[model samples]
Target: MQILNVFLVIFLIVAAIMVERTKDLLSAVIIFTSYSLMMALLWLLLRAPDVAMTEAAIGAGITTNLFVVVISRTRRTEK
Candidate 1:
């Protein structure tokens, strides 16, 4: 349990950095979705199923889709 906690913390830190440092809008959105999934897992491990489900739905599902849509619409027309 303790080892898993430490690893989870490290993973979260790395994931957060990846999400922020990623330059491509599409890649950033994907990373953000993954980050949300990680957060949902952490919430589940903390025995908060409701919050986990909410995070999964709102953060991973809806928010990610919205981001993708926005990015797709705003994609630059490279000549």
Candidate 2:
């Protein structure tokens, strides 16, 4: 579990960098989705299924949709 925690932390750090450096909104959103999935996995490992479910739904699902809608609404930002 400790080793897994270290690995997860590394993955999250990489994902965060990817999210921050991405120029395209859509790519940033996809990285965010990956971050959310990682959060869910961490929650599951910590024995918090409820939090994991909420993270998955709100972070990965609804948030992604909202990002997509906002990106669609703004045409100038598209690459």
Candidate 3:
């Protein structure tokens, strides 16, 4: 449990950095989605199941879908 938490935390940090540094908008969105998922898992492990579910639904689900839609209508790479 402890190890899993630590790994997820590290992945979150790296994903965050990658999202910011990435030049491809779609790639950034993918990384951001993963970051949200890791966050949701962390929240679940922390005993905040309600918050975790909300984050998973909103952060990973709705937001990612929205981003992909917007990206589809525009350029996929940063200029």
Q: Count the backbone clashes (under 3 Å) in each candidate.
A: 0, 0, 0
Q: How far out, in Å, is residue 46 in model 1?
A: 0.6
Models 1 onward score TM values of 0.88, 0.88, 0.96
Candidate 1 pairs with clashing backbones:
none
lDDT of 2 by residue, 1-79 (tens): 9999889889999999998887888888988999999999999999999999999999999999998889888862444
In terms of lDDT, the poorest run of 10 residues in model 3 is: 8-17
lDDT of 1 by residue, 1-79 (tens): 7687677778889888987787787887877888899888888888999999999999999999898888889962322
| Worst 10-residue lDDT window, candidate 2 | 70-79
* Model 2, global lDDT: 0.89
lDDT measured at residue 14 in model 1 versus the true structure, 0 to 100? 89
Model 1 poorest 10 in a row by lDDT? 70-79
- For residue 11, model 3's alpha carbon misses the true position, in angstroms, by 0.8
Arrange candidates, best lDDT first.
Answer: 3, 2, 1
